[model samples]
Target chain A: MEFLLQLYADQTRWSTLPPDQAHAEMGAYAAYTQALHDAGVFVAGERLAPPSSAASVRVSADGKASVVDGPYPETKEQLGGYYVIDVADHDAAVSWAARCPGASHGTVEVRPIMAVPTAA
Target chain B: MNSRPAAYAVAERAARESYGKLLAYLAARSGNIDAAQDALADAFTSALERWPLDGVPRTPDAWLLVSARHRLFDRHRRDVRAERLHGALAAAARDAQRDFERAGEIGDERLAFMFACTAAAIAPEMRAPLMLQLVLGLDAARIASAFLIAPAAMSQRLVRAKRKIAAAGTPLPRVSPDDLSARIDAVLAAVYAAFSAGWSDPAGVDPRVSGLAVEALWLGRLVADIVPDDPETLGLLALMLHADARRAARRDSTGAYVPLAEQNTRLWNAAQIDEAESLLRRAARARRPGRFQLEAAIQSAYAEYRFGREPAWNAIVALYDGLLRIAGSPVVALNRAVAVGRLRGAPAGLLALDDVAVRSDLRDYQPYWAARADLLAATGARAEAYRAFERAAGLSVDPAVRGYLLGCARRLGTAQPSAPSSASEGKSPG
Candidate 1:
């Protein structure tokens, strides 16, 4: 089963960290990604730009479009990054999620990717 | 057997006896639990329909296996993913044919299937419920009630879990010896959780909650048989059996709660105690101690009372000390404090209880309050004991236990010859 692990952490905390500490944190994430690759379960992963760079978009019933300045439903913790990996089950996804550096100071939410049915 | 009722009884008996074995064999072969379950359900439906008209087969299990195999083939043939499923079904059919020739006995892959249920990929909380459904053939509603989950939510959880198992391709037979210990721990925890769920409903007023204890025992015994040398497995079996043996003595004839210290030893099942003792002895020979072994040893200490001897409280206290070192759970600490009270005195017990009172988890835990009340009463602190008893009674979910606690408080209040203070009469509101 494939699962999408959303890594959420407070964006403000990243800015307050000392330069060396931020570098070390990035190293930890690099090591985690390397481990996932070594396990042959890694499919795709990317660290996102801060929520400040994000825009919220909406389409109304009459097909009118509206754009907002920041991410939708502003919250303390932001979706800092995400990893989509093919693993055995939810438990396996959780195990990987725990290994992510974000889990130490933040949260790693695991959601199974819905399997798309093929046309018969 | 040609009669519909007779055929139904025969089919039901066969299902009860071999559902896990059949499902395990099918799922292990196909590597898809969801499909295997659907095929087996269809097979049972066919059995109910055909057995009366055609007469029950001499080897009902083999008949069912053949029926289920055909269903699997047909179901897959209609699927867009038939080519891939065909290979697995073909292999399963070959095994089914061999087993059919062997007559009544079907292959037992239940241990592997059970291990699959506890795979690292599955969520911890869902493991036991999934085992109950897939391995034991229990309906989701019954399992939901036992676990205190909403029926619809439980059904969705089970469906999603089954989908994951099918999609993830959990290697059933490849559970290597390197990870067996960890896997077995997961399996044992699930079984114990199931047993605890049933044991909590002491009165057995709900039919849904009552049968899980037996099913868990059956699962424990099955695991013990498959992993004969694993001491912890035997220890778990012993622990469960010791508790089960005392089930009859947990309540009095009047349906009042009977604490273990005052329970009638004669009411306990001697046969089950003997089995537990032998299993514990076998576990001890392994020379490796675990949480279950320590717990079983404590229960064994109490079982000595059945022999007309005072319980070996010293050994029990020592066992709890060992348990505290490993588990250190509030409940274990509370129990240990109670044991310390028995071996030492109320003051020592109170000191011990005070040590664990700092844990926030024990604030609403009824047994902690009850233990404190008992020790307070022992030290002649009647007023404090009365309040603690009231707190414990208010926290208790069982009506019998609440009534018992209230009775204790009432006794304490009446023991004083003077009219009770307004504070002591706090149990009643104006």
Candidate 2:
């Protein structure tokens, strides 16, 4: 089981976390993930670059695959990072999702991974 | 550099091993957010466990969706917050809330998912992968296999797609009666590809593939509702009806095997045949061409002659040519080769199919080899043909196909005596 914690912060709430404090909070997130890893439940995790560095693309009707530069549609909130935690079930995934600093600060989108078709 | 092919394959394998189904029991109660998400999470976890052992169940889409509903109900029982999430889904048969509405995004059901994936904010390369993941519930690794990339690259693409979809906040396209026709095109194309993976499964033993066809049909019906007058929409529905009408007849009563030309036409679906014929005629008269209408026309033509006259290989060939012009793909070319074989002999067809082997997507596809076996035999290369038949038999998930191919191989004097039916078959979408 894997839980994806989608982090976002309202401008006001985000700006209030001073740079130094924000760094400390991120450190806490790292520490929590390390705990998960040491316990052998952590699959993969990463902090995303700010939305400002994002890019987007779409295929037009004429069959053209096009690329553009931007944080895909502009929104006030931005995705900060993600945590993929391996656990027993939804309950376990939820417990792990809550451990992410984003849960306290922004919304976390937790999704379970799909099993693949074994080679015949 | 850190991602080795074997390791990448293993990582991809892990992703596929993890899907499970959740039951949101309280979905009938209220619009509880936590309950809903929890149910979704639970269902996904179940998807992971169930698929490997049981293979994907027939109602996987509904299974996951229902899991969410069940999970929500469980949550409702446990917490006051879930009452609404539980209620909304219960009452949602008619008055469902559109899940996501962003700028420039519209329509209901899976299309919303597709539009989000296709949203301008996401990269062009990200669109198909996103839809493959979210709507079809494929893992990044399986998706990576399709694109022939490392899991990391595929995972990165998905992440990039999600960020754009989230940021775009674009309004979902609201299809008016006027724009409905065009909208249906995009919707059908998306649904067609996904559903095809299900519908084309030779492994009829596994029922899970049924969801793929059912969902595609569901989406096609939705498209029909909006553009009821669109002949192409009608064609798609009619075509499916026509093909499905022969389901029982396609195989013998004992479920052994019966090819289309040998099947009794009296069992042919007259209603579906009628519907497809009408739709095809209408579309042809319109003089405007679309892929669905063309493909449907081809099927209708084939079905029409399947029982009565010699199969109309000429009309079928023409249809494939028209299809190639609209969507020129190697798979399309492979299909067209069959038609050419009918007209010019299997020898000519094999000459054309030589290029099919190198194409990556079709490498694992069993039919490609099966077709090659037939062509080789027809051209008098019986030994080589038996080998081809064996290769196809080795890869096929369908018991019936395996039986049929093995029978062919035996006839050619090359046979394998022991091969167990391992694991299960592909999901046979209805």
Candidate 3:
């Protein structure tokens, strides 16, 4: 099954670091991808920009449609970037998710992709 | 080393020894890497299926190699029996079997097989397949699966490659020490290609994919030893070794994603950093002037900065400047933009990014958006930053990375810092 492991961090925390510190920090991200790709375990990965570019929209109590440039939220945490992995089982998926650099501070939601049916 | 584990080890060693032997035979007989791998795989599967019952052949390798090679001929003859006269196929098989029967005799058949597979007559792309098949002696089943092609189709490519070489009179491309410079790049390129094939984890979703990096690095070192003074060759080796240094700490204790800045600095490898430092120094000192030298320097600087020290930023910037003069590719410019971000703060860095050519060649590379989005976010353009993050998220193949970018977008939507009237004045690049 394909599992999408989503991980995120606050952009503000990282965005304004001195360039040296920022470059140092991005090394971990590069290393992370390199580790997986080296092990032949990495399906795919990439780095992202910050959060202010987001737009959130939702239908309110009035039942009206609202559209925002970012994404709608569940409580405080929102949908960040994700990794789609074709692993053998849930245990492996969880193992991979736990390795994400942001796991200590943020949440990683692991969900299986739904099989679409085309029944007549 | 004498127990149940020992017994298991002994058995495993025996299997590998026999397997390698069978591969040697196949490589010799097939006249190319692909066909050799196919025949070797058939031998291996037959062993796996029959070993439990027959208790492993006394000369299991010879038995399997001869059996698998001849069995394939049997099938070919059976399929094309109507044109019995064209059994020149059988003639080659008979001749090969006779030669193989003499046994334990050698004339560098494996090396020649490799040369044929990596023959210049074949396209550049097929060289890795040939090496992975002939040099490493991996089976066709595994190699084919890794490349994500049908076995039959892969077999045809191998056969066609072999036939082309056989017809070309077996003029093996030689790289004597004097003329090694040009050929060394091609050789290194093949090694890089091998790792690239495995990097996507094409065959299975298992951790087995990482083995490709090991293979590539090993091959890189092998070629390096053959021609030691080649700087770019050493640079590729240093770069891979340095990149591979962080294998253990990439994930968290729970295996979730970990960004580099957030990763436990304690876990980064000192040994790898030292190795990279020495190698980068050696390559740079040689003054060979090549892309590998600059890229390795860039990465070496990155590895050093992992410790929170201001690295040789000026030297790295100089290296990128050299790269622009040499390759003039947008990717280099984009990377140079990061250095600009460091040397002259984010605004100047943004200007550098803006100045980079991104019309057709680099419109789709994810790193470009990632860099642009960083610039926008730094300057308080949150919405545009989010859009750039989204593009980066979609363009990359890595799951962890995509998830990370998406997280960045999510975090920005929920959190906002005080807007700086002048982002250029916010933080010094130093």
Candidate 4:
């Protein structure tokens, strides 16, 4: 099964880190990614820009579109990054989620990807 | 004797013993469970049609394997990809055939198949049904009957489960010991579920249904053999064997329910008791006591009674205490209370029930009410005891048990008004 882990964190906490500490954090993430690759489970992942620079788009039922600035600002937690990994079951996915760096201070939401059956 | 009837008998016996082995072996080798099942079904049909005329082959399993392999080859020949791999497929089939002919066993393929059938990818609720069908070759109707569900619904559930498994692709290689140990509980639960289904009715009117307990025990024994050091597996085998040994005494000559304590110890299967005792000893050697081991130990304590000897109620109480410490379920607590009632005075047992009484799940539980009535009657509280027994009789599904509880209530009512009832005089619940 393929599971998506969405990492969420407080924007201010991430922004306040020292430059060298931020560098070390990135190195840790790289090593983690390498470990997943070695385990042959890595699918795809990416770090997102800050919520301060984010925008939201909504399409009404009538098909009229509206754009908002700053991710609406009321949301305290921001989506920082995500990773997709192939695992055996929910337990395996949860075990991987526990090892996520985000788990220490923030949250990682693990969701199983529903398989859309392909006609054979 | 007609050869046709004798041939059918041999086929029936083969279905009971070798169906799982042949199906599991083919499924593992082919990596296509559905196809393997289809081929094996066809093989069985062919056996029924041809066995009488052919006078039963010396190596029935090998004959069935070869027939199923041919069907597999025919199915593969239709696929373009299989056409390219014909040489490899033929070579593999030959090897499997040779192995089957030389040795009746499938090495560890059945074990591998068991793990695959209960794989985590499949929904937890569906594992046992899938195991019954895929491993034991039980049809959907029988599996549905065992689960008390409509056959159509059971068939649909099976289809969905099988599709999900097939979608996941070929079963993964043998899992690590850590993974095996983690899923051991669920696997054991499935086997026990099958056993309970069989043992639920002591009359054994339907051999297909009643024989499930034997199959489950066989599966448990095979698992214990494969995982020799797993204490819980040994414990599970012991538990099933202990319960199975008392099958004969569970019902009276007239088919009335016989509670464990009132059963004739001579009716118990001596060999099964011996096997269960040995298994319990082996599991105890592991020193990591699990729920099943504790439960088996309790049964072992009861099995020690023989030749008009009193049961070691104190040992049973201690084992129940150990079990309560580990499991802590209301049901186990109720059982422990019965044991305590047998060992200590009725008042002490009544006091112990208070701790478990807080659990809302036991409000209408038959055993709880039955145990409570026994304790109440023991303490000379006839009025409360009568009410509890009435409630227990109302709740009991078994007619014999309901009759017994009603009899207890009537006997208590008719006793002299001033006399305190001897609650501890009757046999404890099984």
DockQ for candidate 1: 0.01
Q: What tens digits encode model 2's per-residue C-alpha lDDT throughout B325-359? A: 98777666777776677668878778767765565
Encode model 1's per-residue lDDT on B1-430: one tens digit a residue.
3567876766655564466787787677767676667777877767767776677778777787777778767766688676475566557656866885775477777878887788777898899999988877888999876765556778999998887777767446467788777778889988877776623321112112245767788889889888998999999999888877877776789976666666799999899999999999999999989888898898888788788886787898999899889877776777787778878987998899899887745644556667778888888889988777766654443445555666677678888522211111111000
At residue B205, what lDDT does model 1 achieve? 20
Which candidate's TM-score is highest? Answer: 1
For model 3 chain B, give the 10-residue run with minimal summed lDDT. B421-430
TM-scores for chain B, listed for all candidates: 0.83, 0.62, 0.70, 0.80
Cα lDDT computed for each candidate against the true fold: 0.73, 0.55, 0.58, 0.68
Candidate 3's docking class is incorrect
TM-scores of the models, in the order given: 0.67, 0.51, 0.59, 0.65
Q: Write the per-residue lDDT of candidate 3 for residues B1-430, one digit (tens) a residue.
A: 3565555444444454465444544444433433445555666666655664456567655575577656667566676652243243344345555655675432233333444556578878678776775565555666664554445566677667666766765335444666667656666667666765633221111122334666667667755665577788888887667656655555568554454335565677778768767877788778886866666676677665476776565776788899889766665677677667767776887888888844334444556666676677777789987776665544433454555565565556778722211111101111
Q: Between the candidate structures 2 and 3, which one is better when assessed by lDDT? A: 3
Determine which window of 10 residues in candidate 4 chain B has minimal summed lDDT.
Answer: B198-207
Residue B245 lDDT in model 3? Answer: 63
When only the first chain is scored, the TM-scores of the models are 0.96, 0.81, 0.70, 0.91
lDDT of 4 by residue, B1-430 (tens): 6967877766655653466777665556555666667767888777767776676777677777778778768867788775444443454456677785577545446666677767778887678788888776778888765654446777898988877766666643477888777677777877776776522321112122245767678778767877888889988898888777877776688765566667788998889889988988988897989888988887777776655666788888888888878777766776777777778878888888876787645643556666788788878899988877765554443444545556677778898323222222112213
lDDT of 1 by residue, A6-82 (tens): 98989889989999767556645654575567557889999998899999999999999999988888999999999
> Of the candidates shown, which would achieve the greatest lDDT relative to the real structure?
1
| True interface contacts reproduced, per candidate | 0.00, 0.00, 0.00, 0.00
lDDT of 1 at A1: 94
